[model samples]
Target: MSLHELRLLPWTTPEGNPCYLSADSDHSALSRLADDLEAAQLDSGAQVLAGARAVLADPGAGERAVRFALTRAVESLDDALRVAVSRGRRIPARHR
Candidate 1:
């Protein structure tokens, strides 16, 4: 399939490569699954951000606590950015 026909899936392969879906329609089962996963990833990122902010605002938060929050925030940010890129690629050229 041509690059424009391929959809960038929400998850990566075990080798850390981007995954693509080549369904004729976006309503395909795999495409729906990817949509659901992307929504979940965004939701999780929001939750992580809220928790990280709480940790940062706490004067008593220990080094470990801060580090853990930072780590989770980073992971969530990565997932969110991946989702954004994937969605951006799917938008029609005219829309951009």
Candidate 2:
């Protein structure tokens, strides 16, 4: 199936293992829920990036604060990666 027709949602199991679900159609209840969650996660990631930039600009920002921001950023990046992977699109090597 074409990537555009698929909806991918990244999630975690109760044990904290990363997981994902994919649906060919977006009208399903699960697909809608996944859409909502993905939107929220992307928004949150943007917010985190802003906050991290602010913290980085502050000379007084402690190591712990920077680490925390980095951690969140990494998690957000992973989520984005999962979303992209679920689309089943082959990213060009030059883009990497």
Candidate 3:
């Protein structure tokens, strides 16, 4: 089946392994939850980018402070990536 026909729900197993559920409808409870989580992650990434920019522009910002901001930004980026992968469609590459 085409990836667009499926909705991927992100979840974690008890052992912390990444897990996903594929459903036909986007209105399922798990799909709705995934959508909410994705929105939160995207918002967090945007906020972190703003904060990191501010920190970088401040001459008084110490190395530790910059590093901390970068770390958080990386985490936010990771979450955003997870959310994107969960909902994104895979396009087939054309033959050369």
Candidate 4:
């Protein structure tokens, strides 16, 4: 959860250049965050893939995971949007 919250911090600085967090939190934390992101991406992708395969096997099971993943993604996005808006940052309209 700390790692996820760290990623919510901007990757680019105000000058639009990529930078890292203080040395106290270096690559290890970033790597863990990256791993988490990768896992989420894989989970979302696999959810779709499994759903597709389930369409041939047990339609209900496949539909359930896919719908759950989509719902999670939407909720995560909504939370991010609310945070950004509250912080006075520019958020995309779709997220609003």
Assess every candidate by TM-score: 0.92, 0.72, 0.75, 0.30
Worst 10 residues of 4 by lDDT: 1-10
The 0-to-1 C-alpha lDDT of every candidate, in the order given, reads 0.89, 0.72, 0.75, 0.48
- Best candidate per lDDT, number? 1
lDDT at 42 for candidate 1?
93
Q: Is candidate 1 or 2 superior in TM-score?
A: 1
lDDT of 1: 0.89
Best by TM-score: 1
Q: How close is candidate 3 to the true structure, as a TM-score?
A: 0.75
- Which ten contiguous residues of candidate 1 have the minimum total lDDT? 1-10
State the weakest 10-residue window (summed lDDT) of model 3: 87-96
All candidates in order of lDDT, best leading: 1, 3, 2, 4
Candidate 1 stretches greater than 4 Å from native: 1-4
Q: Model 2: what TM-score?
A: 0.72
Model 4 lDDT at residue 28:
71
Q: Per-residue alpha-carbon lDDT of model 2 for 52-80, expressed as tens digits?
A: 89889999999999999999999888877
